[model samples]
Target: MDRVLSADEIRWIHDFLELKDITYYDVQVEIVDHLASLIEAKWAAGSRQSFEVLFFEVFKDFGDHQWRQLLGAKQKGVWRQVVRNGVSIFLNFFTWPLVAYTFLSFLLIYTFLLAVPNAVNYLQESMYLWGFIVLVTWGYVIYRRPAKRAFLAYDGFVTFLGIDLYLVGWILPDFFAIFSERFSATPNGMLGLAAFYSLLVLVILTFSILMRIKGVQQFYKTYPQLLITQ
Candidate 1:
């Protein structure tokens, strides 16, 4: 007499495929149902065959090589979707807020620097020195942990901050003119100070850009199949 498979047995097979990672969850369920129906039809012939024997026969006909190819294709599709979703969610959560915060930070720092009459004063000079140190430290951190999510957030923060500093430095002349008029400094001195500030901004921007580019390249190299595996 024909042997029959219970619904629970079908579910078990599906779970097995999932646990083995032989197929994705959705595909595993579908494949299990289809195979079970095929087995049922075969067993309805009234031949006394065991479930294991019937299953392997049906499975072998699926063509091991072809099934592997199909699984590989499905894995690629799933991984791409995973990576795309992760990046989309990350950008949604952090992009705009980071940009706004970085812009405000740049404005506050530049305002303080402009307000200080003596740039050479210990406090003023220390601020500039610490700012430079922070930028370099961020660049190094990104370089070391290129593939981490934290690194991506840090890079975005630094890039926007650098752009803000660059813009403020470019417009320093207008602010310098007002300050010089009140303080009685020559335009030459104001121009010299602005040039130095612009140069520092440029250096920071360049370093940030270079570090970001290199870090991205390294991330891809380290996880070449990260997108496909996700």
Candidate 2:
């Protein structure tokens, strides 16, 4: 029979990971599982080496610099997954059953833009509101995120939020004056364009907020031990 690691032995693996600076909680989960499997395999093979010895022996097989390289690669892969997930979720809003929400949002924005005295200014204000929503959503995520335990996916998603802020808060506001002057003579045109842009901003902001919430739920679900009251 293959002997499984004792609770203390399992904890030793965790401590080893931390000692190696693999601090991201989610990343540690994968490496810990892999290390456990390797250690158990040696036991099954009739190796009587102690747990600590087997741990290092297995780690040693990865070559002197290979373990760090492997960790770096995994961290990069996690960030890529984060971007792919956000894009997929954002695209879903424009498809199938969710498309109705997208349509209605556009209609409502167009209606409001038509009634407003200054469509451009209204659109700018709408962008600011969406930007604020993004910030508040980010704040909630930060509040709920475990202080001592970090997740690569969660950190990657927050980085996306920072880019969203740059676009909505800084980039859009700067070019608004130029665009507004060009469309000044065409209020109808301005209203349609503003409405479309507003809807786009709204959808992007919604994506950021949803990504943060879902990311938190997922990490917590997978690692309940890391759960903390917000």
Strongest candidate by lDDT: 2
Measured on C-alpha atoms, candidate 1 has an lDDT of 0.52
Tens-place lDDT per residue, model 2, 93-202, is 67866667767767776676677676657676666687777778778877977777667756765566476677677876666656666764575766656555656566
Every model's TM-score: 0.36, 0.75
Give the best candidate by TM-score: 2
Could you report the Cα RMSD, in angstroms, for every candidate shown? 13.4, 3.7
lDDT of 1 by residue, 1-78 (tens): 456688778767766665655634444544776788888888797656777788888888886676667667765654
Q: Considering only N, C-alpha and C atoms within 3 Å, which residue pairs clash in candidate 2?
A: none
**Candidate 2 Cα lDDT to native:** 0.71
- TM-score of predicted structure 2: 0.75
